[model samples]
Target chain A: GIQVEQSPPDLILQEGANSTLRCNFSDSVNNLQWFHQNPWGQLINLFYIPSGTKQNGRLSATTVATERYSLLYISSSQTTDSGVYFCAVPGGAGANSKLTFGKGITLSVRP
Target chain B: DVKVTQSSRYLVKRTGEKVFLECVQDMDHENMFWYRQDPGLGLRLIYFSYDVKMKEKGDIPEGYSVSREKKERFSLILESASTNQTSMYLCASRVMGGGFPEAFFGQGTRLTVV
Candidate 1:
């Protein structure tokens, strides 16, 4: 089993501001993913970066697999970005690839 | 577009009652998963299936069971519900292979065991 810890449990930002969220894992992982739980409670897949970096519009993520850490970046934050961001890492192998998630970072973007 | 649909968005059950949560996917994915999300603990996997009739235990499977009778459907069952079982249940599906398989999730079912 792996332990995941997320930093800055809570964050508040004004419109057009930027922020970064981090996740650190205790063991090596073959999978790492970032998800955004919108106000409506829909878990949206933001990034699946096990390593390297990826960007999608205003959101980007980087995972340094060697260091067992990942970062999620939100640029020009908007009110719509206000929600909880979660980072997950899966351990074990084969069909039972279970994901262990962090406590999550709650973001509040004031308009 | 891939769609994961959960049978119920909200449900209430009495203690010791049997409960079933159904999930269906339209993309013909080879892998399906069930997870329960709780405060502070985030999401914990309950069970997952790789193929029809095949199942595996996850981190937290003590109170949950899953069934995949068909390729497109995965069901999570609670033999006897308890008050502690109250949480938001999410279903997800993903491909077996390829680079960084992204799991498409359902809208989630908020269950309360009273």
Candidate 2:
């Protein structure tokens, strides 16, 4: 089983601010995804970056597979971005492709 | 639009009651998963099915069972619910091919066992 850890268990940012959230895995990961759980409990897929970099709107993510780390950057954060950000990695490098999620980072963006 | 729909948004049951959580995906995905989210524990996998009539145990599968009778539907069953089983349950579906296979999740079902 691979362990995924997310930094800054809780974070608060002002509107128009930029922040970076990090995820570190205990082992190599073949599949990794970032999710945001809104206040209403809808888990939204933010990114599916196993490697390289991807940008969606003001949110971007980069995964360095060799280093077993990933980073999510949010630029000019807004109140709608407030939620719990979770990072999940599949078990081992080549397994059943089931995701093991981290404890999640709670984000609150104040406007 | 691709969607995963859960049967209920909230539920309350007494201990020893049998509970069923249903999930349906319209995207025709190859993978369906059931996970329970608890405070400080993140989301713990309870069960997942990659195909109809097939099942696999996840990290925390005790006191839980699953059925995938049809390709579009997956069900999570609790034969006898306990107080500790009260938590938020999420259903997700993903395709087999594609980059990393992003999961589409349903708005979670919050259950409480009295």
- RMSD in order of candidates: 1.7, 1.5
lDDT of 1 by residue, A1-111 (tens): 789999999999999999999999998877799999987677998998889999999999999989999999999999999999999877654444656789899999999
Candidate 1 lDDT, tens digit per residue, B8-44?
Answer: 9999999999999999999989889999989888888
Error of 2 at A1 (Å): 1.1
Candidate 2 Cα outliers beyond 4 Å, as residue runs: A93-95, B97-100
Q: After aligning candidate 2 to the native by TM-score, how far in Å is the CA of A42 from where it should be?
A: 1.0
CA shift at B31, candidate 1, in angstroms? 1.5
* lDDT assessment of candidate 1: 0.89
For residues B1-114, what per-residue lDDT tens digits would candidate 2 score against the true structure? 789999999999999999999999999998999999999999999999988998899989999999999999999999999999999999999876534477899999999999
Model 1: interface root-mean-square deviation in Å: 2.4
Model 2, span A26-96: residue lDDT tens: 99777689999999898998998889999999999999999999999999999999999999987644334
Native contact fraction (fnat) of model 1: 0.53
In terms of TM-score, the best-performing candidate is 2
> Which pairs of residues collide in candidate 1?
none
The interface root mean square deviation of candidate 2 comes to 2.4
After superposition, which runs of candidate 1 have C-alpha atoms over 4 Å from their true positions? A93-96, B98-100
